[model samples]
Target: MSQDRTGAGLGVDRQREDCEALAARNGWQVVETYSDNDVSAYSGKLRKGYRRMLADLDEGRATIVIAWHTDRLHRSPTELEEYINLCEQRGVTTQTVQAGALDLATPGGRLVARMLGNVARHESEHKGERVARARMQKAKAGEWGGGIRPFGWGVPTGETTKKVDRRTGEETEVPVLDMDKGVPEEFAAIDTGHDILLAGGSLNSWVKWLADKGITSTQGNPIGTTEARDILLRPRNAGIAVYKGEEVGRGNWEAAVSEPKHRAVVAILKDPSRRTTPGSEPKWFGSLIYRCGRPGCTAYAYVTQSGGRRYPSYRCQTNHGGGRHAQKLDDYVQDVIVERLSRNDAQDLLLPGPGDVDVAALQAESEAIRRRLTDLAGLFGAGQITMAQFTEGSDTARAQLEGVNKQLGRAATQDPLVPLVGAPDVRKAWDAMELSQQRSVLRELLEVTLLPPRQGRMPDGGYFDYDAIQFRWLRGPEPYYAK
Candidate 1:
């Protein structure tokens, strides 16, 4: 006995009863029973009971096969052909409650089974098409597609499903989607990832941080680099609906991140220049964050040989004069950033985000500027204004439009200093960060320019001059050290 799914299709229990009744009417003794409940014959999914039954027939344990109908036993034409061949070898006479006895020992019975299999396959195909169309419609309207609940957002209200235990034949009730209940922590985690990426941090660093936080994917698997990246890059996170693997339109659910942030992240991820080199991640905190201050030189400081000294050193990549002990330099940079983060106005060092700027207003202004330029063009074409007047008006409108556009662009591209904005123990937080993250933070806040070595040496090793290593603030006014 077999049953594909509930509703429209008979339950496996009913099918089993009917088969038993038919067996009793024929005075046939029931030897063993096999049922693949809730498993579709046409889905090509593995059916353990079906396989065991076939083995029993081949071993001569059973000389006959009984089912509710031929279609239930086999839906695929290919599967039917295989079953027919196996039955012919065992001379297994088939019995069904609704359909009459099928003798596969002859060509006629095999032909009938094959024909029924084709009809069952066609019906299943049509059903699949209908279900797919319904899913597409739901997605276009931004409705949940009815499956496991998404990570941050809730599913459609009151969605539950019955999960069957293939081994014990037990039914477990499970809620699939509950759109009213959202996971606040997961939503914040996604925003953290977006901020990290915009700050020039790697997805691998985010994965490590997530692991340390004891958080996994919604599916309960360890979130790797790829999964972490995919979760943040999902269109649904931005309230965009996707169907059949392509975005359809806006979703009904609230967006987790701003549209500008999402678009910026997407551009960064999809850029052709993104590095895919394995093990190419930066090992030094100040690898490329510090630059050579030699005259007319634009080389970044990098790790170099230290002449058998235990400590590692950094030198100008272009072989300019400036170099420093790597560990000491990294520590000094970390101290500066930690001090800045510990300040009361640390958050002020970040670029403006969606909360600071009215993105919609900027967008509207940009559109209005564009419309004015169009009107100016129309005025010129209709001979309403002289050429000189037209040129002046068009230029002015275009300039205004450019400024508005720049504001709109900045609205989407916020500063990547979210992690260190407010920390109780700023030094501890800095120490906990990955090298890549530390480098990104340094690059975001200030520039470290490694100047040339001292002109005259006094001690065994020339003393390093702190003033020679110039600092320049990027987000705010330069401090004493920066000046």
Candidate 2:
């Protein structure tokens, strides 16, 4: 039995450790330990140790693979299937501390193994969906969702008082109070605790202060700079929760500091120069797109500093500094490129061709799904079906309706005319979209690259080129743009 402790979170690690301890008590010999860090389970792109373990298995190195659970092995269903096939070929047995043994040799065993694997995969996906939904709800409600607690705030609890000590190390039970009122209350107060601490001094100083007072997180780690910064910046401590990168409503926790305090701290942290201190030069187009054009300069084109002035420059980080080149930014550069690429002629290049979708059929399908949903609702309201039956039918109909709606939305948005003919409106819509949506659109439209600036003069004695630009029609470039 072995464990793959790759990319397991802190909570997962504790669970795995407990499982391992239990397995040890049962006298199961832990044969080998395979650990991979910061590896994505979603892609399963052959982490160093996992790849070696596969090779070892093929070479008859180990017969049994042990993990705390099936998910600890592989999160993706495709990867799980591939691993199961490998185990079967090698006549290897897998023993999970929680799910027990999964043998693939026998027909029944194989079925059970696949089912268990699928269950684990389904649970992972469902967990992600649940989290996303929760975050969306929180965001819509304008509450702060999960992240590190800020400096001045403490975790709100049901308890009225907590043990506290002054800077002099004198300990006493301090009464917690509601932020709006100055009077001490019999309940734990919630506020952005970490932000209050950061606003007072440097994160390093705060860490030392907490350590000197013997304060530690629930994990027993002394507060560090990273923790301190995380606490200050996290929206959760500001009486909001965030789930899956979206802000949600404030939690039921008591306030340690007011919302205004957290907002001020966040405003300062978001400004890179202020956060970094010593005020660096402005990065006007820091995350903006650049394409590479140099013959050997495969590096992405980006803005660079020259003579105390910022210019759109392309430098091959892979090559020596001599490979650097510059492109002038004129009033019409971005507008011209955007206009040209967004022209009617270029619409086909940006969007899928007619053969990619069937407009008439899609509309008919959408209408049919909507009708079915209406019928289901009518049946429920007419008392023709039981509530349970109506709910089931309505849910199925609604899901199908949602699917069709999503397909129609995608087609409408991706239609060539939508961007080319309605350029102004499209631009307005793009601006209105959230940051995440903007990122999605940019990825969809551009196969960007950075190229060395053009040196030759044009017929009009004007040399115009871009440090980086998108290869407009290309799906992706070879090797350089591997997904």
Candidate 3:
């Protein structure tokens, strides 16, 4: 078995050759070779090659194992003892090019192996600490620590300056990116995307624009919707250095977009209900609560387009079909809502009625259902349960879990807009808010209903009446009509 955590340069190949030479000199035939490249043995990372070698030894398939050094074979003392126990049981011996042979069959050999293991572990821990400290220092200094290329930036390459150590008379080359390493095309795209978002473009619109322009990710793959969103949210694209998820400070490189614009884009994306792609209609006022008002209808009205101009309206998905012009309806509804909240006792509207329904029991039920589903999955995987049984059980559990989750969501909904509605200038505060925020406020206030148009009257066109729009307040008395 041969293994190298970092397969940089010719180190792994040299180690392999050395192991082969040692085998040849000992007159032993190499039956199989196992290697795990770019894997770490000291970082609690799984070493596949090492595990495979242990399996081979356990099966009595290998009598001896050769490594470059003891550290290469083991770092943790616990791991060392486990391997030693395995070797002793299998009557297997270990040899290292640097530390000579280890005979697990003897007491002295075990002592030496444990001592070496401790030393290797101590060195590995200190080295890891040093590396972490160095990375933090680099982040604080606004210097890029080498890693995967960030979106909107190209591979960093620049000049190196030789600096001489006075006492030791030693010289070392220091690397630096005196000029920006960003690709002009990518930089421009980022700026364009930022501008589009600032100009009220949706995430869906931005991704479609990127696709139309043939803009791809750093790896030349077609940029995905989530990836595009992530690119816009990356702090590095805004010339900020982030370490361990927290923003450190401004970075050394030029920003692809301004900080303010970047923050705006972030705020927009943070809206949970914000649509990613352009919907059928450009305007979606009151989309948060627009519902079909037909008797016993439980369908949401979606945006539908018409003619050359886009018409924002909510049409039922079910056959109970009803629609309202988004602009006209919103205007009339907002006027009534503002009038209602503008009253002297408007602050009363923000008060909490009876306490929220406790979801503790429902949450416990959800967790229990999840555990049962996991157990079912295990039984199915082990062939203990038939496929049909597994499927039926999983589906039933999932449905129960979903119903519980929905109940929990309803229980957790609180009006964060209470403070805004209670403000002195409630309308001004509401107007300053984003559409999504406004929608949240509306959801807290009332349930909107869009009744189907009168018989034979088209739901579209300019002559739609105002009586179709209705609001049923959760706390206040009676529904408000947009007259």
Q: Which TM-score value belongs to model 2?
A: 0.33
lDDT of 2 at 69: 72
RMSD of each: 10.6, 19.0, 14.6
- lDDT string for model 2 (1-483, tens) is 122232224444565586678568777766656755446465446677677888889898888787777766777667777887898898898877778877777888878876776776677678778977777676546454444433344434445654423223344555443332221221122232333332222345455656766667645677766666676666555355455553334555444444445554555445464346533322322133444455655454444554454444444445333223343432233344355445455444444543565655765675576557557667888988889998888788768755654454343233222333346654554444333233334444455554444567745576654333435534323222212
Off by over 4 Å in 2: 1-29, 34-52, 97-100, 106-108, 150-483
Best by lDDT: 1
Better-scoring candidate (lDDT), 1 or 3 = 1
Q: Output the lDDT of residue 175, model 1.
A: 73
Model 2 scores what on Cα lDDT? 0.52
**Distance (Å) between predicted and true CA of 477, model 2?**
59
Ranked by TM-score, the better of candidates 2 and 3 is 3
| Clashes by residue pair, model 1 | 155-179
CA lDDT, every model vs. true structure: 0.76, 0.52, 0.71
Model 1, 1-483: lDDT tens per residue?
Answer: 334543333477788889999999898989999978777888899889989999898999988788999877988887787888888788888988877888787778777777777888898899889989899789867888876567787654567888766556578887766653457778888888887777677888788778888888788889987778788878788776777665556778878887667767776677677776666677888886688898898989888766675667888887655447787777777777788778888877877555676778865665566557657767988999889998898789778855654554456664556767787787877777667667767877888888876665535565545566788777765453532
What shift in Å separates residue 33 of candidate 2 from its native position after superposition?
3.4
Q: Per lDDT, what order, best first?
A: 1, 3, 2
As a TM-score, model 3 comes out at 0.60
